[model samples]
Target: MTPAPRDRILDATLTCVARVGLGKTTLDDVAREAGLARATLYRYFPGKQPLISALVAREAARLGADLLEATAACRTLEDAVVELVTTAVASLEAHAALQYVLLVEPEVLLPYLAFRRADDFLREASALVAPALEAFLPSDRVARAAEWLVRVVQSYACSPTAEVDLNDPVSVRVLVTEFVLPGLVPSNMLGVTS
Candidate 1:
């Protein structure tokens, strides 16, 4: 079945946002892209901020699903971190919504995708990496660790020390494991042998 006009508008806008950036995308652009009238665009979006909010929300849900799937196979906490790092870096390179969040509207990512309390965001994030992290971190720290991973990935992507290779997703993945993951581990165990 064909999607509703609102959904169609969103789809077209997402494609445009991914390609031209959310700041540059216009109602006219979305209308042309969606094959709708400008007035019709207003019928759905009302304004740019509403459209942007919908786009960001939809993208967050999509990425959350992807993150859940990618980390499902993880067997250990380090493995979970590795999978999350790999998947997140790779997603940033491929997904338009993530591109918008990472490259254009970073504030969208700041909210962390929890429809409920911000803490729910941490719980959802932890579920993504339960395989590896369930064993490594204490119960109380699991959610906190999840939030940390999310922030670390964004920082890594935005870091100026070395640019992430858009084509080589592993470059950022490796960077995450080497630099960020170690810090997430507790310091009291540092003296212990691996």
Candidate 2:
């Protein structure tokens, strides 16, 4: 089955972005990548900002769906959290366009990561991740925990740490045990004392 024109355009946009970076990827590039006319591309997206926005929305939805599915089989909250982090990290690492932006044109993300925009983006991310966490955390704690979890996953995926490599399951377990689980799970469950 073929994807709709908009989907095709967005996919082509990512291909172009991955190849040339977002700043250098013009509508002509995306149009050519999609094998569609420039007029057809404009018919779907009036401008570059709108096209970028649609692409971001599409990717976010895809990530959210993947996360929900990946964590669905976990038997415990700790397992769920571990799966969440590992899955999210894996997905982020697999995104070519995003990886390119982060590695080659990090400044492209600066505006979104700053002040008010940061909060909005975090809130949106929290909402996407919150559903996967609901089964593991209390209703009231879910949102806050999701926000924190998103922050942790994003931070680790973006900057990484020598102490914990999210790509490694064993290391992810250690991270969940010593850091993540301790926060989401009660101290008694973790056998910890102040």
Candidate 3:
């Protein structure tokens, strides 16, 4: 299926980022991937920061849906949380927007990593993870739990494992099963959680 205009820009941005890194992902490269002219891209994005912001918004929306669905389907809060965190990490690894932001402009990841909000962009991310957490965990514990899960997600994001190696389902699964799941549950259940 043809990607939508916003998606087209994101796809192009990822492609450009992968090829030349964020520093070289020019408007022309983005336009070429979107199959739109440079002028057309500019009609939407006045400049690179605008384009990057749009891409971040698009990715956040997609991830919000994926996380909510994963969270709702789980039988328990623990299961839901693990599924939610793993889904996010996997999505980041798969989505070029996530990688581009992580690799190119790390400040973009401050919300996920640091949860700072000098601007409101990161708030959408909290909206995505908060509902599931609220469903089972008390409101008081929600922030800390989400913060912990975010760290786990970022751990995988910055894993020393080469992209190809970490791409393996076994390696990805191990991260959650060994590291994340245990951490989520108290030490007693750590053995049984598996």
Candidate 4:
């Protein structure tokens, strides 16, 4: 299905930002990319900040959906964590706009990720993982697990101190199984009764 005009404008904005970095991208550049007049762009976004905010919101929703879909079939907490981390790392690595912001204009995204709206991002991310975790965790624990998963994935994606390759599915699964799963899953679930 074809995306709506506003979505098209947001896509154009991302393209513009990716091409010229956020500080250098202008409304005129977005309008040209969207194939709309500058006046029409203003009619839709009103200003640059709103446009950038909308773009970030859209990307966040897309990432949430991607995470849920990637882990939909997970039957165990271990499987879910593996799916979540691998999918998140791969998705963040593949996102052109995100990579552009991180590489060329870290300041443009640092506020959203680390400061101003960081809590909002964490809440949204936790909610996204809640459904997948529900099968293996109680309601109270689900939020904590999801939050931890998001933090770990973000840390690994942003900065890796280890030699493990996040993009490698086998390596990610092994790392999660060996290190993360033992803490997240109950002993009973792993067939070890106390």
**Each prediction's Cα lDDT score?**
0.68, 0.87, 0.67, 0.79
lDDT of 1 by residue, 20-81 (tens): 77667888999999999999999888999999888766766666667667766755555556
Collision pairs in model 3: none
Error of 3 at 55 (Å): 0.5
Better by lDDT, candidate 3 or 2:
2
Give the range where candidate 3 is weakest over 10 consecutive residues by summed lDDT: 115-124
In model 4, where do residues sit more than 4 Å from their true spots? 112-121, 189-194
lDDT of 1 at 80: 59
Give each model's clash number.
3, 0, 0, 0
Q: Which ten residues in a row have the lowest lDDT in candidate 4?
A: 185-194
lDDT per residue for candidate 2 within 1-194, as digits (tens), equals 98999999999999999998999999999999999999999999999999999999999999999989998888777787888888988898899999999989998897777687899989999998999888766678789889888888878866778988888888988887788777865676543211
TM-scores, each model vs. reference: 0.65, 0.91, 0.66, 0.86
Model 3 quality (TM-score): 0.66
Residue-level lDDT of model 3, residues 1-194, one tens digit each, is 88777777877887787677666688988898789988888987889999877766676777878888877766666566667766776787786644666777876456545545522433445566776676656567566566666655555556654632344545555665676555555666444321
User: Which candidate number would show the highest lDDT if scored against the true structure?
Assistant: 2
Candidate 1's error at 147, in angstroms?
2.7
